[model samples]
Target chain A: MHDARYGWSSVHRCPSRHSDGERPRPARPGGGLTVPTIETRGLTKSFGDVDAVLDLDLTIEAGEVFGFLGPNGAGKSTTINLLLDYIRPTSGSVEVFGMDAQRHPAKIRERVGVLPEGYGFDDPLTGREYLDWAIGTKDADDDPAALLDLVSLTDDAGRMAADYSKGMQQRLAFAMALVDDPDLLILDEPSTGLDPNGVRTMRENVADVAADGTTVFFSSHHLAEVEAVCDRVGVMNEGELVAVDSIDGLRDTVGGHAAIELECATPPTELGVEALDGVVDVAVEDHTLTVTCVDPGRKIDVVTHVAERADVVDILSTTVSLETLFNELTEGGREGGGETTAEVAQ
Target chain B: MSIDSVLSKDLTSVRRSGALWGVAVCLTMLATMVAYVNIGRGAPPLREAQDAYGLLAGLVGVLVPIVAIVASYMSITGERASGGIKFLLAFPNTRRDVFAGKLLSRLAVVGVIVLFMFVAATAITVAKYGVLPVGVAVGVFAVSLVYAWAFVALSVAFSSATASRSQAIAAAVGSYFLLVILNLTFRFSQVVRLVYDTILGLGENPHLYAAADYVSPYIAYQKAANLVYPAAMERQVFRLPEEARETLPVYLTDEFSLVVFAAWLVVPLALGYLRFQRSDLQ
Candidate 1:
């Protein structure tokens, strides 16, 4: 399990593992079989009359980069806190590495690295000192200078962490989370205070770690970031897991199609494009033929059929982006009308 | 190992706090000046040195609790308020480790200050009296250290039980007023007398007033310090009437005051840990 050779390829052998819900365990580099990195069953947490997280059942496989997407106050941080056993669940159970999270918190945390949300460094210790203490507590021999270099904070290692800017503190926290080569890296809002460059670097670092067989579970509301790196993303709204699927899977589930606009020399009149497979709609206006397809791959077929009928001049195509799908999912749930959202999830 | 890491880190962070240093400097000066003034008045007899030690003990009994409360009242609640406890617990450390480490580190700080005060006082005594009473000095140091620990434990207990810094500060300050200030000014005993004689109509009961006075930690410290240096009780903060002192019960003895100190040290810590362990830390 500690060997680096059990990379992403081994886990990708079963791409449909998450969908099926009960697949065989993956074999690690040392011939050891390991369970999912995280699993929650009927997990619920409530504060008085409000339910922060309600009946959440999530499973993140090893070597998979799972993105937890939700708006502010949508229970993303509460879910992460439950997984870390920072708070008790009102009902239900959470297991990490096949062990009960509440009962074996220390043992689970020994293998997990976390960048908790809203964390602060009020101590007078420098950035380097904070990293050193983290490494020592984990009983791992991580070089503080190397970790600082990874976050591009080596120059500021001597400065007090409490005095650092918000962005710099976020970077330092990310570096600290990278210590001990953790089996599971849980980042709650890791991109909260990052600039464009820092965000790019963070995305790359996440990709790099997941490639090396580290199960990366990160929570963020940034759709583009989730679309960039996650194998599967879970959408949460109002303490409920509204949807969980790959970006393409979500697009397909929402029945969002691609519209290919063909700017022909003249509009096609009777191309018989309506009869083509996967074509949802076809319209013509002012020398442009717009063909909408449920499956984007049918764009080639639509264009071929249109070329036979008219002189094609240009082609412009647009697929449904994750942003549209995310808005559709979360907005439906947020409007207090969860019926439409539940149908889409199903 | 986790506890050790937390202990060392807290020690490093708390030692740099200006409040602790300010209290330390004041305590050292108080100890030195008390010794210098009393002994420099000429060696009339051996009783002079004992009187100086008694006065120093009285002053320390008052100051040590202040230092301890200041050093520890924010040990847990401050971190919770600033969100620093999240960072500390993000590693593999358990809640037990965090509680134990914070208690021990703050106690260690107060212990060092109490030791320094005694050492400076001992230095002055040797310089003026031409001889050192090592047994008395060590006994006073031991009793003062325990006294300091009791207050530190109580303050840390408050810090652990409270979720906010303001709440912890209120509890610590309230305890100091009730335990140290009221007891020192004899107001606590007066209230007890009023409740027993006036409110309850039980007539004058000096024994109950004496017991009420000793409930305060500083008064218990004086009673315990009397065990080491008998003359220390001659200048008691609240002197019982002659009739009451003649037939003192077991609970009023100097040794029983050690039991009061022990209760102060243990009960609050246990209760605080119970509350902290069950809290959500949201």
Candidate 2:
């Protein structure tokens, strides 16, 4: 059931006739409510002489799986801190669910489940006891066992948290963050210390939660995980937001020019692929012709020329992967017009 | 929302701590031995009561402050150092809520320990002596609790004032010595007064010791206890040389002592609350 208490209406997703003989109509997304889940403008924070976050303008839409990507000391944690109001920004503004984050932190937090970085458990508490305490504070209806089951910690629910392994601790904390059925989940490195299987499970759980109209703002250094899950990625480096784009869009923008590989029946005489237009770094090996095309429109011309000499057995096109794009974007992002590349996805 | 969950979690953790229980037990045994010394040695009796009760009051003055210090010295800083305060702040809680909740938790821990020990001592004294100075015993216990609260507030204040748990511990222990040996501050204050007089050509200052009395919560606790049961206190103190004690400071009255105790209770906690709310919790 969609509860109106969560900023939704009873008429959500249903066609209904209005008063004064208005025609029947379908409900809007969230009953005409399309507020961005989170928005920031010129958000900057400085610690002493070092700026932890600088002039960051960002927006995440409702139900969007936004991945916050940055390396160590890239101000990832500091940006999360500013969003959670753990520390005030030096200048600029932040809004979560259309409410000022600094001024209405309690209200924002009430609807936002968070797994913050460097957090610790009250060690003496058993997993169940700790979750019970969390549920009490969140004022949510939850069974401790049910939450522990979600993280596959039901067997260890009675064990003291001090005795839990690092992976187990992470799972327990994740379970605790789910207690509120939050509208927005702020996860900072939630997959840290998890094994491969646990990471897969966590990815599925995040997908499940986000499917229920919840927006997830996930931060992590795990590029593979981000690539596997995020609808859009926001890259930050040295206190500056370098870029925000869909995975394919980022690949296209950052050295994702097409590469063509051709397998010919016979070695072509005077292949001279480099002499052809839009081709660079041409290499020939094992009776195969490989070249990169900065101008994709010329790929057919190159292939036609190759076919005229010898029967082309196979032809393949490939673009850069997200991992390659991530490295290049972060390594020399500023030198590559990174500022203008950041797109606000509201 | 209420911070009852934080308080309950704190209390449960405190209850399950064996080290804290060990400290409480050792203090209780020490109180028992002090009571035995009073009774077995047949120390002189105060008017209508045994001086043993006064010994208990002295024991509270000497020992309960330690319990108070131990109970809360790391309350906030410990959480901060462990990054647990972040979890609280990440929820629907403010720093002010943590402050109030932690203060209540510290009070509950110290209150249980001190009250239990005081009751056990009262029972032991009653068993040894024919009559219990139920009135004076209860009155002194009340003042001792107030004195304990003073330390609690001071401990929490210093805990909140610092970011490092180790630094909070050092400051709390240092304050314990300073509050116990409060006369050191008075003596130091006297030196300042003497230097000022010499520099300004204003000589012959006589009441410097009176000003020093405010440095020690121990002194305030004892004075408050004695004022409540003057007969027992008088019985112990009249033994001093007439001239040696005759020059006691005017501020050494029960009213002044109570005022000092109240200051200890209010000033540190008030300052801590302000500093805590003003700080940028990282």
Candidate 3:
């Protein structure tokens, strides 16, 4: 609080817009030896009368890749804006690297790199030219050619940015953000619009950057990509974070649930024989039955019994994917009686 | 972080056109020779000829604002349209730096052009007639550049606030004609009356008339190009008309116009910079 390396004078004191400012920043997991790279307490933002992000709390540690999971318009971009200080928040407080973001935005930005949701760049300049202009401000002279190689855009460095494909533009955007060699990289859907190979390259580059002690904060709708790349994941829905944990932590938090899928000759009247002791919910459509259960260990026994009772052609049981876990955590409407698709689908 | 950075960055970016300078210099020289030919056609002495030529070149004043508008119309808008403002503003420098840097560079360019015309006009007048008074010629040259600086600043400021290049150019040119013609006659009647009264006071001796006219910086810049040596400035040559002399103390005393011209540089520039700084690029 009394450090000169980062200080907040009286001019920097932000008014507490809501109860959000009072929410404690989350400490990192395990022994918490590492300092947090990004933290927020009850951070909220509203545009006109609509709330974009509401009472959100998140913490990401140094050198850890964290994925912010949310569907479009579910406040993913809004939260990024708040974190980056692109827009002022209506309530709550955001802290990046333990420094109040509003007070020290320039300093925070000096250490933080961002790839916005859109692949927005100034046209009329070649990719090489634009990178030179961007990297000029930072202290180091970054090699534009090397950056192009990292993002797999080395072959197209001389082309005007306006002519680049959406995936190629996304690659350029990532390269631009990383040009400064920032300590933290915020990538909002970095792999958006990319082919499978592009996505693989993106993941590899993100991993490479994180390996160099840069904390990678990325948001994506592809839950599997998030699970594969992120050491921790935070699930967001309806302007709020529903859960924040490691992939396995989220898997454990949503643990004991398995999806039992079966292909049948006809719609069953009742899945009595298939109703395993641990099954929580069941869905029957066409000739398929999807059973949600607390313990998948009993799924094979239940399927065998169902096969004995009905003309079941094929049956399968597998651990729930990250997509399923995300649906389970974020499903259901805000409070009360509106059942969510996750509830129905589960 | 430093003014030098802003200056160097701007200088580095702008594409200089050698052809523009070549064309501008040739045109100035041609205009000077034409004015000399008129003098050769049995026109009055160096004094009368200077006034006539000065009046013609003072017309450039009407277009000076327009030139400013055209030169600067795309300074900010071009950068904004190309998504360059964000990259530029991301630096620690303020908008003030951008405004100042751009204005200075424009003024420097205009200064060179004004100097070329002034030199050509003086050379032609000396060639047509005998040597003119050195004081009057030097004063005219200095004052013309100042006026050019003022117009350039005015145009650049308008350019910075405008959304498009065409709009900025239109506003600058339109405002120039309005201020020089309609606004002086209609909106500011008092100033026009003073100007008209001053012009009529000029007698057959066009030299005195030209000298009194130089009291108006607009007329003074023209007089400099025409090589019109005002009698008031050269007391030994002729006595200034009593009325022209009376207005002399008021009109020739340019503290007020100088301040107005200075404001042209300061106010619009400040406002333009503020607008650029706060505007959202995306």
Candidate 4:
């Protein structure tokens, strides 16, 4: 029943490896079959006249780190809120561990750990106290010190969370989300206020948990981090999920191309590379000939054509980054273009 | 377990808040002043102690509701406004746990002030009069506790139903004026009687008028307080004729005031929870 446009069939589920023997596996609500860690069908939410999330259909298998990539106001947080049932869907359903999220939120939450966006800490509660509260609420036996160490907040654990800096609070919150060794972790814009070091720690923490068989659903607008850790990403734009694919698949879906900056002995005169098949654009500046192609395979063809026209000296090639793909899918691909590759792939 | 966790966490947070301490100190000072003034009126020690209890009831009946409102009106909405509730609900605790925890924690906060007020009053009365109306003091304490809880419930109900701090504040302040201040001035009962009489054409019905008067939690508290310290009966806004007082309708009796107090405690909270359970925290 999965939508082929989301590329769910190609989603690779890492082998289950329960590294922490001390943490008990949460019992799935419906016992016989392997259930998708999270599944939302036709999920939609509206705030009065505006719909914050629209017609979202997604499925994340166990042990997969699925990135929810979207720009600001792309309804990423809204979808997470719907998954946690913090906000009810306007006219759809979400399931976590094969149980209806709305009907059994507390039960579903028993196995889920969430780092919600714009979360504020209670006054005068030390970082340790916040961790203790999370542990107690989940009835988990995690050592607070270890969690603090994980987030590099060991020294700041004794300080009041209200006194913590944005980055410190983000780290503290990440530690709290790691409590009880949750079966599913949903982090929304987790790296928003973190420094480079803090961002690396978050990525490693996500990877560490995913290795222990936790299903991680991380949402972010930061492409590099999502590209670094996510097994697959679903791009959202203006409340609609525009694309979902593996990093390589996304590159391919967007007609993955490379920009070749050829440093020639002499600038090509009357170069007809633009007329070649798959050649998107060509320009010459000083002693350099730049060729943009719609396919990576066209790189060699352009170089060969250039060598015939003029003496070829050196070549540098850069492949399409996720940023370009994101802009293409969310920006130009949505407004004027009638259908994007993501739509056609369906 | 989740409820306990939420309650204890909230208690720790509320305990450190300066506002709760401010309310407590003010309440204690007021109780002590009322006790000192009433007991110093110079009468037989027994009569003076009883008189002190009556005066203390008047002081608590007005101040306890205000204290409860201030203590609880922002309990939920403040968290929601500051985004603290997202952290609170991030764990496995259900919305029910959050609501019940807030209710109980605010009750505990107000309960401490109510307990301190009675203790101070009792100490002052015992010191000055060398005698104590133990039965009346205990009964008034019980009734005042319920009165505080009733108002706390109402304020928390406002907190839960409102999506913003300003809306909750408006509801709280408006309620205080309508239920306590206006009720004290008999304006609320007068309006109730006007509507009741005009609607049902029950002209000159003293029982109906008395029943309408008891609708306010403030008046219900006085009736309940009067049951313990009969001196409070003189403060009643809608006094029936002597003959009718002896044959009062059930709804107009002191016992029925307890029912009103119970309704005040329950109905608002139920409505609040209904709204809270369905609301999107964002």
Which of the numbered candidates is closest to the native, going by highest DockQ? 4
Q: Which of the two candidates, 3 or 4, achieves a greater TM-score against the reference?
A: 4
Single-chain TM-score of chain A, each candidate? 0.75, 0.73, 0.79, 0.78
The estimated TM-scores of all candidates read 0.85, 0.82, 0.66, 0.87
Residue A260, candidate 2: C-alpha displacement in angstroms = 9.2
Tell me how each candidate scores on DockQ against the true complex: 0.58, 0.50, 0.11, 0.60
List model 3 lDDT by residue over B121-191, tens digit each. Answer: 77777776766646556765666667677667667777677766577668776756655554323333333
TM-score of chain A as modeled in candidate 4: 0.78
lDDT of 3 by residue, A140-201 (tens): 57888889888887888898876898888888877878977888899888888799999988
Candidate 2 local lDDT, A25-51, one digit each (tens) = 222256555668889999999999999
Give RMSD to native, each candidate. 6.6, 7.0, 10.4, 5.8
Ranking by DockQ: 4, 1, 2, 3
Give the per-residue lDDT digits (tens) of candidate 4, residues B29-98: 9999999988344566887788888888888877888899999999999889888888788888889999
Candidate 1 residue spans exceeding 4 A from truth: A1-33, A257-319, A336-346, B39-45, B231-239
Once fitted onto the true fold, the runs of candidate 4 whose alpha carbons sit more than 4 angstroms away are: A1-32, A255-293, A296-318, A339-346, B39-42, B193-203, B231-235, B239-247
Q: Sort the predicted structures by lDDT, highest score first.
A: 1, 4, 2, 3
Clashing pairs in 3: B50-B226, B50-B228, B54-B222, B211-B230
